[model samples]
Target: MASEKMEGPSAPAVRRDPYEVLSVSRDSSDQEIKSAYRKLALKYHPDKNVSNPEASELFKEVAYSYSILSDPDKRRHYDTAGFEALEHGAMDMEIDLSNLGTVNTMFAALFSKLGVPIKTTVSATILEEALNGTVTVRPLPLGASFSGKVDKQSAHFFGVTINEQQAQSGIVIRVSSSAQSKFKLLYFEQEANGGYGLALQEDSEKTGKATSAGMYFLHFQVYRMDSAVNALAMAKDPDAAFFKRLEGLQPCEVSELKSGTHIFAVYGDNFFKPASYTIEAMCAKSYEDTTQKLMEIEAQILTKRNDLRQFETEYRKALTQFQEVTNRYSVEKQAVDELLNQREQIHSSFTTVRTVAGHIGASNGGGGSKAHLDDSRTESQSDDGSSDGKDKSNKKRWFNLNLNRSDKKL
Candidate 1:
């Protein structure tokens, strides 16, 4: 009988989305995950809802959720595991209901002893390390973001997978619950490679958001329009090329934003040239004005330089002429100096000869006639140039000396 029951096949395992466990999307920040866990833990704390059995069960469920997410190896396993794999791990060796009551009793003291505000902080420590993740294309939750290691070459993606699970014996397929729009949050990738792309063969999806001038991912579900054109408009996209590329797209519903993990895909088919995408009239005009302004600034800089050069050349020429005049004046002053020196020497010699003759006449006490002396003086005066003319020339020479001294001082 035991063998037959075992052969009857075990119940299908409940697949748990890693994103759902954390109550965040693939793009969620470490802080966001910690915040979500704190809220959930507080709401389901067994001590807070002692009368509610459901709350008790939920408390344990949340504890379990925190347990897995807090570990790196476990989180990775949970992320990649399909429904079957997750179910197999979900199966405990045996059920234990007693742990819940004991865990609650220790919660307060545990928080205090550890100096932790909440259990979320415990997970946050682990999350700081997990930030080294790459892009994930798995289905994300509302306001959740993509979480995975980003690739250098490939575009990022957050995705959803649909599968048909068989539960009953050979029964036909049935539909599962379908999530609605605005179900997932948008996280703009930090330092994203510009634009988007789509791979025909991939199941990954990605969501992007605009933060500041660039893009980054954050936790929170956003309901964006299905049309890329509309999405760009809704975000008030700053990139003209990004908007234009959206216009060129063939209205793909697949490209539409839905509630799940979103990704940024970069495929060759999605590549666009500027001419291919149509841009808003205003945006194009704005670009033109921007370009024109840059050109005008460049022209103004060149014109200023040219004007400065012309002024410099004129100043140099004027300086050369001024220096030449200064040098010529120096030469003229030197010639005047030579003539003045010769006149001074002649006057000094004449004065010396007159003194000698007077001395000799005084010593002889004689005998020379007054008339004779007078005649000698008259003859000497006649041979000399006019006294007034020579006196005026001597005054002119003295003035030239003063002028030359002044020029030297200058």
Candidate 2:
């Protein structure tokens, strides 16, 4: 029966000889070759062996062999260049095997110029894992946290704006950095009318606990979304006399800012450990309302901190217990090693005694009576049994001791 199409290159591919596939000798005669192809083709023809993909493939393979062997030039090419000669020609051919009407017609392209099929198969397990969501791909080189003191760095400046048409809702912008992370925040704002505005911009560089003290820098600007770009431009050239024309544009220091679309950038620095900060925006009816919301958020944050502390305490307790157990194991192992040494000594002593007894017995007479020899053997056997029993008892004692210590440690 024709087999299924040999599952293609789905399995790991191994190079196979075309000559072997055709089962023809290198020196086979042209007539001998035509006879071989005709016989195989009749048996494996897709029409005759319906539903058999393997038979179809075998049919194609045989036709390929016959085409090359029938022509002197192609046969010579195959003989000189090997199967690669077929692959080279196959790349240029666009012939479709399924449309060929008969075995004779199929022989022209099906064998000599068949399309090259992709031979790789993906593992089902990997595909299933991906579908199950167990696969994780990290496109970023590193996570958010960075190590060692970082220099002045800037992130992509994202523009945030407040709608002037909806001026009833004031805007609150907050920037914060990690504690002891040595990062600080600086900000500036500009008006929509091409005028710079005062900002709660603070000194950007911070160190130690001072980092948290200057965590956030707030700013208020005229209600224009693109004011962020103007503010950035002014900050870039703060000494420019043209920027000086914007009256009342000097940086303003305030604990709170008025409602407006404000744009600001943060500058962070540290001697060790890279620094990162978060920027946030909120809309409220008044500055007091924003402060109240901030108070409520801080309370929630405090609760989270308490939970983290509790977890840390539990971790410490577990670690201490582990250390204690490890120490006890080490002590017990040392004791067991000593006991093993004692047992070895006992075995050595018994072996020596047995050897000495055997020598003495031999010296007593040319050959002691069988009855006397039997008694001596019986005594030696009894001594051996007693020693073995003692050794077993010692093992049990150590085993129980070791278990008791381990249980107490646990």
Candidate 3:
């Protein structure tokens, strides 16, 4: 028996402009676009209009438009080339895992089986827990450390309080796992609602030896994207969803922290094994005095930023040079083509005159045939400084030059 192949969903015959679908202008702000999408999404939600296929389609189109417009790079491409730039698999569809109902989940699974690239986000459960104050948070004083074990997929939270003096000097939190345990170190900012908003997450790096456990250092001026907030925002707006999972920390320089309570989390990364790790919080001023490693890492960060600036400068110069060369080539190519066409016209005229002369000589009973042959030979020699035989060879070479060079080597 042969197996049947499944086909993915086909695109609509007419794809409305994404800006029109979202009911926003091309120059609309990100917040305005987000607001428009949210309004339309709520109105045409599949769960709310289960029987209306039209609403369901509108919902999908709304989501699709948001996916392109929300991303900086994709939106730029779409603006420059329109929908033609997004053909093939250039855009990946993003579906929020948190908001999907049972029916939508089933449809998502079906689409996945049919070979659509669907990017799912992290569940909103942890963020909700923090907002609701349901998660346990232990307090760790400056220069103190705590050791604990977190089950797979679970997290341990620690609160670090900083006073005015400590905030001015800066703070550093470090976490190291035991043996083969792996974990992600997370930092949270307090919201006005007295809840925590996730600010940064750093993946643990392998230290000591190849078989050693993962370690994470949350030093000052080294914060990056907050995945938790991004996920929550995407869930709320739906327009901010991304195709790829956000990973890694971005280098930044911060002078100091505010005087208040900040939270840090250690999340177990292992699937089957629990992670045992130690978390420490210390004032940067004191910590740097004890070890030179922190200073060395800071130096490396500065060096990397300088290197990036230099690379950008070189890239711009090279791009300008390439454009100039391409423009020159286009102009020169047009001139060459015009000259070749004129040469072909002249060759055609000469060939016609030679044929007429041969017919005239035959009609005259070959009386002037010898004179005509001599005249033809003299003309060919004068044209190219070559004899009649060599003239024929040169014409053959010229014809070859006009042949397609698709298979020719450089």
Candidate 4:
């Protein structure tokens, strides 16, 4: 498939830089890069920057960059080829950027070069034209043969006559099917009409009646219709001047028969008993024309079968590869999902720890304020000078105990 598509006129187009659009360095880790993308995305989001075409365009660019960078395979591709590599995969599995206007033209061209086939349906009309044709016969000099009607139980005879003037130049003759003929040729004899001389002889070598429809062989001969010698005796004798002793089934030819009036006799058997069979003589060119057409049709059929088999083999191979790729994509997507979840968990935990630390610091500050208030109260009360020292020592002990506990907890 790839080889076939490569025969097209042009290759796929290249793509622009995704990393530059996202404003991230190639070495940026996933978290830092994604954080930067979020800040840029919010600033340029179409909703936030309504009626701003530049911001809207920037938003689209940011989204595209983030999408590819977020995927491991896509990121690897972008890193390796700086965005051009995304065009090389099959079309069905990707977002067809061609459907998007303007800047997407490059993507469409890129996909075409990747050997992605443009599918088309073959119409029935076109298929019919490919599979069918008519045979045409070219003009040739008309010739004579024999004509007769035969049935299941009997042989038939026809006397053929050709112009004596044309006798020297031999002609081709055909005995072919005429309306509803079922006769399967067994033998043919051309002899003078005067004989009742044929005697039945049983030969074990002869097969029984046909069980299927097909061509059966016949021996052809010719005899002058005016000859007096017994026709059957002439046919029985090997030395008899026979037409050619040729063999054929109906709708076919025997080559080179002399031009003269002659008695032609045919003997054949049939499978299904039909009412009657007609044999008509015709020019051999007609037979040859249809024969060549039939051979061509057979060759075409063989070629079509081979093509269908090859298509089936290629389809199966493509399906297998597609399945494998899909499975890999699924696994990679799952891993990315897991990583995102873990990142969220870590972020949430960090936020919780910061909130707790802030609360602890506020509590410590409140405890220190209360200690300063108590010291001021003791200094004010110390004018009596009786338990001032003891009170100061007690206050110091209480403050130290609370501070020690708070420090331990921290």
- Tens digits of per-residue lDDT, candidate 3, 1-410, equal 12222122433334677788888999998767866775576567655576798986777677777767876656898899776565333333444443566688678667644534344422245655665567899999989998888875577889889888877767777788656465677776665677765555565555663112212233344434434334443444453244212321234423346888888888765434677888888876676554356556666755665665576578668868988999999999999999999999888786677888978878678657778888988997778766667767888887787564643754
Best by lDDT: 3
By TM-score, highest first, what's the ranking? 3, 2, 4, 1
Model 4: clashing residue pairs? 12-113, 222-243
Task: Show where candidate 1 strays beyond 4 Å.
Answer: 1-15, 83-410
The better-scoring model by lDDT among 1 and 2 is: 2
Off by over 4 Å in 3: 1-123, 210-220, 223-249, 252-255, 288-410
Which scores better on TM-score, 1 or 4? Answer: 4
lDDT of 1 at 91: 24
Q: What is the C-alpha RMSD of each candidate to the true structure, in Å?
A: 29.0, 35.5, 21.8, 37.2
TM-score of each: 0.20, 0.25, 0.43, 0.22
Judged by TM-score, which candidate is best?
3
Clashing pairs in 2: 4-54, 5-54, 64-111, 148-272, 148-273, 149-271, 149-272, 149-273, 199-252
Task: For each of the candidates, give the backbone clash count.
Answer: 42, 9, 0, 2
lDDT of each model, Cα atoms only?
0.37, 0.45, 0.63, 0.43
Q: Which candidate model has the greater lDDT, 1 or 4?
A: 4
Question: Candidate 1 on 12-52: residue-level lDDT in tens?
Answer: 12224545755787667544665566567656655557678
